[model samples]
Target chain A: MKENIFPAIRLTVICLLFFSGIYTLIVWGVAQFSTNAGKGEIIKQDNKIYYANVGQKFTNDNYFYSRPSAVAYNAAGAGGSNKGPSNPDYLKDVQARIDTFLVHNPGINKSDIPSDLVTASGSGLDPHISVQAANVQVKRIAKIRGIAEGNLQQLIISNTEKPLLGFLGTERINLLKLNIALDNLK
Target chain B: MNTEITGIILMYAAVVAMAIPLGKYIGKVFSNEKTWLDKIFNPADKVFFKLSGINPLKEMNWKQHLVALLTINLIWFLLCMFVLMNMSWLPLNPDSNASMSADLAFNTSISFISNTNLQHYSGETGMSYLGQLVVMLFQFISAGCGIAIAAVVFFAMKETTAGKLGNFYFLFVRSCTRILFPIALVVSILLLFNGVPMTFDGKDPITNLQGDTVQISRGPVAAFVAIKQIGTNGGGFFGPNSAHPLENPSYFTNIIETISLFLIPIAMVFALGYVLKRRKLAWTIFSVMTIGFLLLLIPTVINEMNGNPAIAKMGIAQPMGSMEGKEVRFGSAASAYWAINTTVTSNGSVNAMHDSLTPLSGMNALLGMMVNCFYGGVGVGFLNFYIFIILAVFISGLMVGRTPEFLGKKIEAREMKIAMIIALLHPLLILAGTAIASYLYAHSPVAYAGWLNNPGYHGFSEMLYEFTSSSANNGSGFEGLGDNTPFWNIACGIVMLLARFLPIIGPVSIAGILANKKYIPESAGTLKTDTATFGLMVFAVIAIVAALSFFPALVLGPIAEYFSIY
Candidate 1:
């Protein structure tokens, strides 16, 4: 028994190192094995950094915008605040977010708000907004970015992700990737 | 949205079927008696014990040992609960959210503290920063618990008698501070590089097309998500779960999370076998699990990608397969992959809603959580696989007309009976619970029954599935079932205790039995369990045992949909 036990402990250690070594190798492989197709940047403005890939631009043209967040992330603090909408301060914060949006883009009606717009996301640091929210901004984005309105709308349409096997989540557009691409257009 | 209740039930069943072999493979790995792997890590274990101020040389029997281990764990569990309860006053509260309700907090505390990250509320508004730190921190610790338990079991059966059972706090701390944390940190960085956001401040409101101001939400997501997957905590930081663009961010990030989900579970098997000096034995279990994962994931993704003819008839042109509740970035294949990965180990966070999947696809996910999720928790998964090995030795010994011996230890009648009891416990809990719930109570605590939300057989199945999942420490729930009732609450509590301990007791008993056995000399005629042939036998035993226990449940759940899919 004594003979067997010592060997076993020794054996277990080698096994752990070996597997972790392989995992490290595989992870290294994934890091080394990228398609190298696209690249993006995290551009900061007004203390908030949005994802900005190279060759991409933020254009209002034909893109939909999703909901607003009270507490948010940008690559660094990218997680949800886990704050509920029912907090006494929650709605007040939403109103403040609405006011901020008005300062950025003047002249949208309150009724045109996307459901996700006022609602807190599971993760406040979400990179994609609901497609519905994106559509709420399509006309204004189209008018702002100044390409043909239909052409801009087509871009947002192109970015939308359909649900899994046709039925998991609503179609969505990546705010970071789309905004970067939008900048490229202009 | 018309909830496809039947479809969800089907996929749930199928996923369970795939998980059984996974359970076996994981068990076989950590059962090693001695290897180079053990020699290396054992020192660290000793160091940890000494650092924690426990004597490293102390030796205790199984009962005293479990008591110490459980006492330590219970203290940690309480500490975790305390963090959640007091999140409102914590400094990590960048969002400054309120503390969770007592019930909700209890559920969350146990859910994540057990490595079963089932959320009773939306993430964005439910928890404060401190709650996440404590609860999600427990995710790493919980998996460590699984790993440490297996390590203890390993020492128990290992021929060596010297050395501590291992420093529980060290195992917990290292798993978080070393393995899980570093990987999560790197993965989060990569995710950020790939455009996933990470921030502490709120997103500033930006004006949109129709001129309405909308506050775009953002937070410290990348790192949290990275650890969530690594630690096998599927509780979404976002309310919409992983599908939220904020949570998932990019296709690159998606791939990282997918791979991370499988990382520890798969590697543990390698470690287990290597330590046991039976790498091939581990490989066999791995093969069975990987094959099962591929089988379920591939077909589920394919079917979902096929696009629902129902929608096509209306000329809506479903975007290539089961796109409902899936991210456009990931599409069907990725969703299928995520589904398989999550349920492969009882981590049930989905990028897409299982409630909306196809009947067959849904069944696959369900089956994985049920049976194939043998790799359910980090350490527990392998422990289950060990039971299968013992069972295989017993059955095969009868077949070849020789007394069954595993690793030169005789497979006695008592050991066989104990192994068989633990082996069947999961299915028994899952099926019996499902049957009773479906037959007696179909209404969720909150209910409005519509055809889309059938409250009969399908609804009942959902309730049963959720309970089975929770008790089994599998976190995936049939979201359609309002399972927050006292019945579910109490029943699941019992189930969790039983599911976790039954399998553990089996192995502990075996280890005790093995501690007394004398090693027999290997002979040419001795059928070695460490070989490829034995691996296949072990694999067969796991598959057969799972089939026997849950075939009826499958027929009632996922297989029923297989017949229904026209």
Candidate 2:
């Protein structure tokens, strides 16, 4: 037992020094060339700074609604609400989201609210919303902002990010970027 | 788009290209023959053996090997539990993260030691630097332990009756030094170059462009991330796992990370062929596993790329498929491929969320883990598959009216009993655990509140996926289950330990016992295991066994969800 135990421990300690120390230093040095020097990509708009990679919350009526967040879009502690369908709390949460969406967009029926709009994204910081999620809220946004529905539709068209190579993820709108564009519109 | 497609093709080509030579190198190292690494590692091996008074030439019986494996694992487990539970006082805790609770510590210690890195907690906020080190240490050791046991079984199959299996200590060390560590170092360095953080600092407070400040947690991410993927240890440095930009920055890193997950396990298969000088048999086995892998990959990619049918009803353009739980950086094709790759190898790291996948895609993930033998984690994958091979050989031998034998050893009733037990144990643990969790959830609704994120069939899948992942020792979660509570922590911990150790014990023990039996040389009348028929038979055994046990649970979960979604 000692034969294997002692040598195993020795090798483990040796590995620890290299894997934890030297290997880490090398990687830290390499991170130097990445977009933010490994500090995450930052976007500066109107004197405010935001991480372009992370999802931002846009709950106002004139802007596109961001995907529901489990952690309320806290990038520092991002995760999904791990509620399965059978759980009453999860069902209630979805129902509550549906109710809230109906209240905001009175023109849309209860069934029209997309799951993406009600259920939270896995990464609570998901920055994009499904094109349906974006479109469903267009009426509410147009009514509040006094913008033409066609103009809002055009804005949606301009803000849409196509799937890579035309067939990867869904066509989606970055709520932060879209709302920024909306705010800029005269 | 052409670049991405070309890149995917190139990655596959590169993995096969690297695996062949790497496999040959591994064969040489383990066979104790002369090799290039002998110059540096030879001295290191000798010095350690000399100090520890271990005879590198001394062989161990299967029982002895098992004991050594268990004892060393127990030691690591204790060390890991202690460190994790005392995280607050530990050094390098720039975040001053509080120590984990007892149940979580138990769950985590068992999870890593078992090589199933099913993390119930997020990385950045949950653990400190020292805690991550402990986890990283276990990742190497756990991965090494798996390969070493496989090496033991490999040697056992080669030796004559009562012949000695190679020393466990030697193989374990070599597995780390010659195999896992070197590759991990290179990959870790590459990831560093690609922008994964390796700093020892705590959370960095960032003032965003919106003037809203958020504290971005940081740690020794690069080193952890490297081994985390390569060792098939998928515990992430951040909560969203590789989905987080820092963990997997660009297409280049994604391809690298994806390749690293399968490289060693695939190489080990080829290594078996090289070592045993049975290239045909090796290829036959490799083909079966790869076919099974690609079979699951096809639908997952299609379903995810097809996007959600429900969304299409709303007249939304879904040019990209279902991007709900996936990142744009890693599109549907890559994410779908990654889902199967990670599950198949027990490398549970995710560039996308498995929980957010369409129902059919989610089933694909569950099925991969349930099958659990497609180029599994470094060493144990081959070990797990060995059980099926034995059964197939025995069954075929019976069909042909001949005595059952494997690699020259007679597959007697004793051997059959062990293999049967090992084979049955996988589904038993998964189904039983899921049944328990589901029954509890069903009977105790209020108590199980917030336990599942999605309701109905998808909810059942979260429970089923959890157990399947645990029992397979592939630690990827459905991610929607509130799994951090005591019930999940303790329950899954038990499942992980049983699932991991029993498979190792059963297969290695069978090899050990068979090693002591009378050797029968292959004759013209002997059943040939290297043929395509034998491969098909083995695949059938895997399918029958997995399907029989998991079909009902799967139907209730992913299949039902699939029908509803469609």
Candidate 3:
């Protein structure tokens, strides 16, 4: 009985770990099966959608406008521009993005611009924006609607997140939700 | 950076003060089993005793409890060994990958279970969601196991009149249910509040400006980071590690991360002294570990603060000394803190890129890993430190011509042999491993080119540091070594196992032996372990051991690196 007790305890611990390992394998298989789908599925933001190519037009009017992405798919495959932060090529890219922003955002000036809107996030496909980024476009959107800028500001205020539960991500507007809200207003 | 003054000061004050009180409270609570907490934990206590076939109702001499606990931990080790071998096929893999190769798998299992978590492959790239769950889940349990063991030992030794080695089951259950769990809950809620994503979904792809769809990584990251910090298991869910913006997010989170790295370690040290009536004993041990911590920390801080001179000459600001491998919000001080904390505790999680650290700064980070103190990680550090303390007790015993005794337990020849083996194994790996790596280069082609081209003092140092850190379970690397290959991987694997189990087994056996002996009352002639003089001796012993084992290697590695730049 004494000998059995020690062996039994050892066997239980070993068996528990052995099963946990097997369970982990099963869990890995399941997570992998679900993993290959894509980020939107992983994050559960199915409402968020975009074209795979830059030239593809986004004609949805009810969705909020996202910053134009210059990232391209090519025969060469996927990657960032790889331009150093201070490179002229990078600067020129930024200039071109700003021009596009200005054309899309009529009557907006340099003073009202949020740098993040013009600049790409590190991963280059950010779906959210700094509250400041949303606000810069707020004035233009309000003017287009012939509404009070105050109401537009109110719209942004209501949309701003509290950050991760209370302390994680920076305060920002969800680009998808804002566009949907715009349609609701009409 | 300037605007967060009130917050930073408050954080600093809170960490320093709250750390002391929290530590003292844990110490007092675990001193004996009289609190309300005992009632709640008693059930688990009873269960553990039954599982071990021990009578919870029957009092055990310390030896019996030690054997039961040791046997349980050994079973856990084997379980990890088995689980890691097959974790790749498991679930939650946003990225489907297979098991780490045998040696690396073995090392990684030991790493996390030991509260080391010194990972070779990036989490996002290498592990499935299930692997993280199974492996990291054990991190929490093993971490709790270590803390409980430490508390049990402290409670055992603290009983001056009659040694009441508190129930191992009670200690294990309470430490997990009470301490680790509650802290993890608070931190997770706070992190979730801060906008760190907490969803459990598969990968989500978004079309990009470049006209290609990009797959974004996602999972139960809040759960991962919470335990990573609380358990002092620092592996991140993503490849870029904690540096990934999604994983860490912002400045407030950054500070919280820093505090998480140091909290339990600091508390454990405080508990050590409080266990003995001489509160100073803990401080003495703290002083040795702190000195080792600061020796590396200050240099890394200064070098990083100085900025790369080349970057400065090229008209770049170098971003205030944290330009390389660091986020802008954290700046230099916090990065320095992470580098130091992980190395001292052997946690191996990094907030910045070690490769980009100024040469001297990087060396300090690497060296700190070699000197991983009793603060190394959850259950492991105290075991390592106590071994040295035993050594110090014996060595001093020799000086005075008395038999060595610690905490009313006499240190014998067998115990000394175990301590010597534990101390020597680390150095042996450093010297022997580097010699072979350097020697094999003449016949092999892999490591011959990159950093080893010159093959002088500098190349040797990098190899030496690699083995030293790996073998010691101190996970930081020189980042210069070509360690991603089979030769280095397999070599590091052997070193990792030897450095890991040899250190653990010796002390546990010693603990078992000590537990069996009848307690000897303190005498006037017995050398007090809790004194400043002894603290100094402890520091010297630790320093001398690190020096004796790896100093020659350090001379070749960092010393040569310094000469290379000059």
Q: Against the true structure, whose DockQ is highest?
A: 2
Q: Give candidate 3 misplaced runs (Cα > 4 Å).
A: A1-186, B1-13, B28-70, B81-91, B99-103, B155-170, B209-212, B394-412, B446-462, B478-486, B509-526
Name the candidate, 2 or 3, with the larger TM-score value: 2
Give the per-residue lDDT digits (tens) of candidate 2, residues B1-566.
43334445566778889988888888887888788877887887676566656676777888889988988888888888888999999788887778899999999999999999999988877898888877888888899899889988888888463658888888887887778877888887777666566666677676643445667666667778888888888988888888775677556688889889889989999889987888898899999998898899888877877877655554434555665666555667788888999999998988888887888888888888988899988899999899999999999989999998888888999989999989988888888888898899899999898797778888889999999999889999988789999999999999999999999999998988888888788889878889999999999998999889889998998788777746
User: Best lDDT goes to which candidate?
Assistant: 2
The TM-score of candidate 3 is 0.72
Query: What are the models' TM-scores?
Result: 0.72, 0.87, 0.72
What tens digits encode model 3's per-residue C-alpha lDDT throughout A1-186? 343347535434533443234333333343333323212122222354542211111222223455433332111111122222223344465666566767777776754554444443322233455566676676567767776778778777887765434433235565545554564565
Deviation (Å) of B53 in candidate 2: 5.2
Q: List, residue by residue over B333-374, the lDDT tens digit for candidate 1.
A: 667767777887777677765654656676677767766444
Candidate No. with top TM-score: 2
Evaluated on chain B only, what is the TM-score of candidate 2?
Answer: 0.98
Candidate 1 Cα RMSD (Å): 10.6
**What lDDT would each prediction earn against the true structure?**
0.57, 0.80, 0.59
Superior by TM-score: candidate 1 or candidate 3: 3
Question: Which ten contiguous residues of candidate 2 chain A have the minimum total lDDT?
Answer: A82-91
Each candidate: fraction of true contacts kept? Answer: 0.03, 0.25, 0.03
